[model samples]
Each structure stands twice: as structure tokens, then as C-alpha cells.
Target: MGESVKYYVLLILRGMAMGAADVVPGVSGGTIAFITGIYEELLDSIRKIGPNTLKALLNEGIPGAWRQCNGAFLASIFGGIAISMVSFARMITWALENHPILVWSFFFGLVAASVVYIFRQLTSVSWREIMALAIGLGLAVFVSVARPVALPDYWWVVMLSGSVAICAMILPGISGSFILLLIGIYPVFIGAIESFNLPLIASFLLGCGVGLLAFSHVLSWLLKHYHNVTLALLTGFLMGSLNVIWPWKQILETTVDRHGEVIPLVQQNILPLTYESLIGLPSQLWPAIGVMFLGLFLVLGLEAISNNMSRCE
Candidate 1:
């Protein structure tokens, strides 16, 4: 017996969800992978994509190399992510620009539910795991609040930022886009994307490939040896990251980009009514809450389906 086509389709859908999450600044594709019940397998698959696969290709042929690299799964997942990022990028960008609070509110619920789901994976709540969770939480908060540091517009710097940000992107709680923002290169990258600068795009993507390969190995090893601590730390990362996506926020400062577009440079979460009063905009409190529940139930529903499938297997 083998996996049905339906299984692969589901995997693609899961990948799409991860892609959608990645498009949001405060959310993570890795967190989406974790909540969708494929975190370990995804890590393992990424870790296996290395030099050995080439040797397998020479010795055992393309199929052998593919098997060694788990090509089918990677292809399905990455393909779906590609499709989704392309399809949803415009829509999400529009939503965030026009309905920022509502958009963030939905993801707020999604990530909140994710914290509970990931925490439930722990078999026990020991002191060591507790410490790990605290550290992860602190790190997430620090990163969320950190001010942007502007680097020179150099190619090597772009590559370095890509490598470092890619590491954060794959981590469960961190946001690669937000990390880029904190690095003060997000707008440049966006400009490149808009202009289709092949050289810059290639540099960044090359960095991403290198970083993903390197970090996946380290993360896979950590999960294998210290599952409890790592899982707990990841759960904490999710908990702390809620600050990044809080629905109501007060903009403390704004900056003008190279394109002359103004964007938030500093912000702090605020209560809904306080946000309305301070920002002089409708908090849309009821609509925000409803969307939050929608996002929450969506994750729960997916988790239930995943659990049922696991039992069937």
C-alpha cells in the first residue's frame, strides 16, 4: 500500500498555509508547519538535502537521489508554497494595507492557538524545559521590540541579511520579514522584488539556500537529542510572538522609505478602545474578535483532521 493522491494534495494545502503565514510579518511559515502536523518531517527532509544526494544520484541514479532527498515531499511542499506565495502575496499585502487591524487580528488568533497546540506536545513540564521556554519567550520579545539597524546597501550585506533572516524564518516563532525590517533592509528587498532585480534576487536566494541547509541540520539534531526542551522553547516562541501580531497597536513612529512610502517604524500594542481613542479610528472590535475566532477554529479544525489521519495510519 502507498499514500493516496489525496494525501499529497493535503500536504500541498498544508504547505500553502505555511506560505500564507510566511507572507505576514509577525507570523512564521515554520510555525504553520509545526501546527499542521509536519514539523519534524519537514525538518528531517530539509536536513537530508545535502551533498550525499549528489553521490546517490551518480551511484544509484536520479530516482535514488530523489529518494535520499525526499524529493516528492519537498517538491510537493515547496511547490505549494510557491503557488501560494505568488497567489496570496498581493491579496495579503492589500488586506494589511487597508485593514491592518483585522488582518493582524486573524493571525493573532492563529498564533495564539498555535502556542497551545505546540505546548500540548510536551510529555512533561520539567524545570529544564521551563527554562528553555522562558529563554525563547524573552528572545522573541526582544526581537519584536528591537529597533531597526540600517546596513549599507551592499550586495554582500544583502546576502548576509538573507542568510541570517532565513535562519529566523525557519525557526518556529520568528518572522523572516520582520527580521529584515529590524535589519532595515526590508524595503530594499521589496524594491528589488518589484523591480525584478535578478542579481539581488539571486544573491538573496542563494543565501537562503545556504542558510536553510545549514540551520536545518542543527535544528534536526537539537530536536533529535532534546525533544522536550526544543519543543518547549518553540512553544514559548509562539507565545511571545503574539506581541508582534496583536490586533490593536499604537504607532509611536513612522519612517519614509526610498520609495517615499511611509511605514510604521515603532509601534506598541494597545487595548482595542484605547487604540480607537488614540488612533482616531474604529477599533472594529466586534469584527476583529469574530475573525480571531475564525482563525482559531481554522487551526483547531486542521489539527483535528491531522490527528484523525494519524490514527488511521
Candidate 2:
């Protein structure tokens, strides 16, 4: 294949990885983008989709606007993300249901490795950076542990949830679906996807469009002006998020869903032995540990390959 085709194909695979991560409650697609070495480019492309691109389309025409906004790259990435979400949603949900420990363990390793990767991005650490890290860590921990708030299942509510969730989805440490869960709209959003409810999905997508455009600008500005502090904070966010993905947890509370099904609401982390004793189920400890290492090594391997590719370039 030509170099251009090869590059686009890699972008699509990265997008698929991002989509897969976004589906999980504690994984961030932005984290995938960051680790894959495309986070800044992704943000810049999204930020380009505003007034300048519109003017180019109106005045300079389609081809001009496409070049201005990096249309081909955006299209390839989004196409992959859409395909992965639509195709893999059911499969991921099934895995979560049947093999929760393994699924969580794998992502747990991803996030833990990601924290180290992000931390190493910093050139120097100082007291101010340490404070920023602490703040980010504390905020993520608070949000992760907070109780879910019940929201009315209205059209507007769904839109609002999408807006909020999309913003979280793009942040390195935050999970958009987890945000939806905290707002009590996760099941509603997932149902729309699984059932192919066009109207509902359209509303959510509209919200996502608005949120992505607005948040991208802010993130781009922050990265430009305060790169180190922001990286530190993001690293802390990833560190704090590890609590959510930890494999061994005991449900502390349950709530009835819209379908009148009981589901876990609040959970507390526990030792593997404690999980076995209290939950009275196989903790699956050894398998989970093995999967965690697999995830860690996967990230490390990807990073090494990326470095080699950069050197070749």
C-alpha cells in the first residue's frame, strides 16, 4: 500500500481502539488517543471544524475546506469509531456481563500503564505541578465514588447527558459512559444504541457535536499554554481512575433500573481473598492477574512500536 493509505489504515485502527475503550465505563477513548500519539492532532482537527472551515466551504469550495480541516483524516477516524461502536457494543456488553473480572482487569492494566506513560511526559516536577496532580486525582476519586443521581428520562435529559458524557469521554482519565452512569442515563443511552433508536441516537449525537466542538477549543488552549501542569493533572486523573477499574470489588448497594432489574450501584474495593469470602464466587484472581499483565505489556509494546516508527520517519 501507498504511505498515505497505510497511515489512514493505522488511524482507523486507532479509532477502533478508542471506540472500544469508550464503551467501557472506566476507560477513556482520549486515553487511547493520547497513548497512540494522536491526542493533540485529534483535538486540533476537531477545533478546526468551526468558523474557518465553514468559511472555506462556502467560499473556497469542498476540496479547499476538506484540506483546511483535514477532512480525510477525520472521516477515516470517525468511520472506524462508528463502526466499532455499532458492531462491538453488544459484544462488549456481553463480555462485561459474563467476564467482568477479566474485562476490568485488562483495562485496569491499560490505565495503570497509561498513568506512567503520561507522568514521564513531564520535563520537570515542582510544587505547583504536584498540587495540580493532587487536585486532578482528588476530583477523579470524588466523581468515581459519588452516588448516581436519578434523572427523568426525557429527550432534553438525554441530550444533556450526551453533552456531559462526551466531554468526559475525551478527557484522558474520565470515562464518558461512567459519567452517564453517574447521571443515571447509562442504560438509556446504551438501550438507544442496541435498539437502533434513530431519534434518540440523533439527539445524543447532536449533543455530542456541540460538546466536542466547545471542549476541544478549551483543551487545545490549555495544552498550548500550560503543557506541563496539564500533563501532570491528566496523569493524576489516570492514577485516581485506577480505583474504578480494579477487578476485585464488593457491591455495597443496588438499585432498580428502568426495566425493574436490580443492578449494582455502589461498590467498595476489596482484596481478592475478601472478594472470594464475601461474594462467595470464584474471585478469578489468577486469571485476572494474567490479563492485567497482558494489558500492560500490550501498551508497552505499542509504545515501543510507535517510537520505532517515529525514528524511521
Candidate 3:
């Protein structure tokens, strides 16, 4: 492949990784963007889509606006995300249902390794960074433990929820799907996607676009002005979010979805032995460990490959 094609292909692959991550409620695609070294560029590109882009479109036509907004890059990343999410959603959902421990264990490893990967990005050790990390961690933990609320049965509420979820999705530690779950709209959103609910999808996408445009500017500014502190906060977030992906959990509450199937809406993390005793299911400890290691190594390997690629470039 040519150089540009190769680069876009790399982006697509990265997007695929992000999409896969986003499929699981406890994982954030933004974490994948950070791992792949595209987080800032993604923000910059998204932030460029405003008045200037409009001016470019009017004066210089589609090409100018496309160039202004880094259309190719955005398209490649989002295309990959779309394709991967569609492909992996079913598999991940099935795994979560049939083998919850293994699925959560694998993601636990991924996130754990991710914590190290993110922490290494810090330039210096200081109190501000530490405090930020503490705050982020506390906030993430609070969100994880918070009770789920009923999604308001209104079009505007759906749109508003989408906006909030999209913002959470771009934060390295926060899971957008988890946000949906918190509002009791996860199943509704998922069903809409699966069944092709056009109006609902349109409203959600509109909210996403608006949220992206507004949030990117602030995030980009923060990264530029407060790089280390921001990263520290994100690292803290990643650390605190581990609770969401803990391998062994006892369901504290359940609810019936639109499909009339009972699903867990509230759960408490538990030990493997405790899980076996209380849930009366095999802990699957050894296998979970194996899968967890696979996830950890997979992240480290991706980082190594990305570093090598950067050096070669």
C-alpha cells in the first residue's frame, strides 16, 4: 500500500480496536485512542468542525472543508468503529451472558495494563497530578456505584442522554454505554440500533454531533494547557473504573428489558470463592486468568507495535 493508504489502514485498525472496546459497557473507546496515540489529533480534528469549516465550505467548496476537518481521518476511524461494533457486539454480548466471568476478567486485564500505559505518559511527579488523579478516581468510583435511574420517556430526553453518553465515551476512563445503563436507556439504545429505529437513531446521532463539537474544544484546550494534570486525571479515572469490570460479581438487582428477558441492572463485586459459594457457579478462575493475561499482553503488544511504527516513521 501507499503511505497514505497505510496510515489510514492503521487508523482503521485502531478504530476497530476502539469499537471492540466500546462494545463492552465497562470499556471506553477513548482509552483505545489514547493507547493508539490518536487522542489529541482526534480531538483537534473534531474541534475544527465549526464556523471555519462552514466558511471553507461556502468559499472553497467540499474539498476545502474536508481538508479543514480532516475528513479522511475521521471517516476512517468512525468507519472502523462502526464496522467493528456491528461485528463484535453480538459476540461480546453473548460472552457477557454465557461467560460473564471470563469476559469481565479479560477486560479487567486490559484496563489494568492500560493504567500502567497511561501513567507512563506523565512527565513529572507532583501534587497537582496526584490530586487530580484522586478526584478522577473518586468520581469514577462514585459513578460506578451509583444507582440506575429510569430513562425518561421523551424524545428530548433521549437526545440529551445521547449527548451526555457521547461526552463520556470520549473520556478515557468513562464508558458511554455505562452512562446509558445508568439512565436505564442502554437496552433501549441497543434495541434501537439492532432494529433500525430511524427517528430515535437520528435524534441520538444529532446529539452526538452537537456534543462532539462542543466538548472537543474544551478538552483540546485542557490538554494543551494542562497536559500532565489532565492525563493524571484520566489515569485516575482508568484506575477507578476497574471496579466496573471486576471478574466476579453477584447480581444485586435485575430487571426485565423490552425483550422480556431478565438482565442485571445492579451488581456487587465479589471474590472468586465467594462467587462460587453465593452464585453456585464455577469461578472459572484458571481460565479467567488465562484470558486476562491474553488481554493484558494484547494491549502491551499493541503499544509496542505502535511505538515501533512511530520510530520507523
Candidates' C-alpha lDDT:
0.87, 0.90, 0.89
TM-score of each: 0.95, 0.98, 0.97
lDDT of 1 by residue, 131-150 (tens): 99999999999999998776
Candidate 3 per-residue lDDT, tens place, 1-313, comes to 5988999999999999898887678899999999888899999999999999999999999999999999999999989988887788778878888988898899899889999999999999799999999999999999999998876646677789889988888999899889888998877777676677888877877888889889999999999999999999999999989999999989999888667889787899999999999999999999999999998998899899889888978
Better of 2 and 3 by TM-score: 2
Clashing pairs in 3: none
Sort the predicted structures by lDDT, highest score first. 2, 3, 1
User: Model 3, which residues run further than 4 Å from truth?
Assistant: none
Instruction: Sort all candidates by TM-score, best to worst.
Output: 2, 3, 1
Top candidate on TM-score is 2
Candidate 1: C-alpha lDDT: 0.87
